[model samples]
Target: MEVKSSPYYYSLALLFILNLIGTDSLWASPYFQSGDSIESRREVIEFDESLIEAYQADEAYNYFKNVREESAWEKFKHWLSLQWNRFLEWLLSGISEGNFWNYMALVLKILLILGLGLLIAWLFNKYYVVSQKSPPADQSELNLSEDERLIQQKDLSTLIEEAESEGNYRLASRYLFLNILKHLKDYNFIEYQFQKTNTDYKSEITQQDIRSDFSYASRFYEFVWYGDFKLGVTDFKAAKMRFENLIRNIHNSKTHG
Candidate 1:
């Protein structure tokens, strides 16, 4: 019987052979010239000699010599020049000895691999691990315009009342202060975006000279909102005063400016 080969098998074998050849070519090629090789070797020898000389020099002797010297701009400039020369020498040595293109190619390959890996991870997370689970259609869409101010105010009042009644004074203070800030922003007394951390907002308003008032309120609010710290009646009163003062100042500034 005549020998026969499957076309699919042959094609696969050819592809595998081609890949092997390409890989070999990529790795085995001499990446530097002979002249460059000699120059690099000579430079390395010089560097080694210089390093040995420096190590043999007495550091204590050099420090003593410099101690008696007058501090002058010329001395500083000379020292800087010496440092610059050393830097340039090392830079040139590295370039002459290094496979620059190969290094760049390696970095690019690593980045490409990392990007692909991240893309795959994201796809897995989105599709397999935490697949989309839609909320009820009616509740999915938030009505931002429908009595939003009134709704926010009511929520704010409820939180305060609940905290006060339950003796959760910390919670009451935090909610009250945040509601004041929210109202100030809403009323254009202050230009601020919601969901920003207090630290970030504090930095923005630093030049406005409201740091003390704003920071006090923010710190108290943070303790109540995120920490297990208990708030006393005194602390609550102080926070309330700061919040009110902050709002008043912001509104006054807006009106004046």
Candidate 2:
């Protein structure tokens, strides 16, 4: 005959059965059902292993890059330290050897270099790139003999008349300017220096009205002569009028004075 089990044993057995069932469910894969075969599980395990390997490779590469950067920085620091030590040693040795005069000479050489640089900069500013386009104060006439100078000092009025007769209005306008300057020179209103710019003469003319007339004539001369503008008969007439005005003003000032 079969023996009957105790109630406590029977309850314990039921609980163990339920716990096993719950644990099986808890341990099941979320991607695949618990019922999947071993082959499917093997493929998923291989995929996880490949992912881990790839992650390990990326970590190794990053570690290698960090090591290389740190090594480069250390090398640069070492080189700089070596250079600094060499410089300190050289400086100390030179000082200890009583070569003070040599050091002084070096300092003097540096100062000379600095002075040269400053002089070059000054030359660039003064000559290469003039701030104001005014001509140099030393530029006037070319050197010539006294006899040649006498021959060249023909009267401006006669030159103008000859130029007009030749139908060279451009040349005549130039002579008209020279005549005004000659009159100015004779009256001692302004020094007729070859190096003197028109602005210089303008400054010398203390009279406002006279300076105004000179400015007009000087501007006309600069434009037609230096500007490369083709001077026609009409331009010549205007230039002559301005020159005449300048001459008359100079004469009037002289007479009044």
Name the best candidate (by lDDT).
2
lDDT of 2 by residue, 110-140 (tens): 6877999999999886543543343223222
The candidate that wins on TM-score is 2
| TM match of model 2 to true structure | 0.40
Model 1 segments beyond 4 Å from truth?
1-151, 154-158, 187-195, 255-257
Q: For model 2, which pairs clash?
A: none
Each model's lDDT comes to 0.63, 0.68
Q: What's the lDDT for residue 80 in model 2?
A: 99
TM-score for model 1? 0.36
lDDT of 1 by residue, 104-217 (tens): 755666687799999999888655444233222333222224323533564776767777788778657756766766755565445555455567666656435666677777
How does model 2 fare in lDDT?
Answer: 0.68
Q: How do all models score by TM-score?
A: 0.36, 0.40
Q: Cα miss at 62, model 1 (Å)?
A: 24
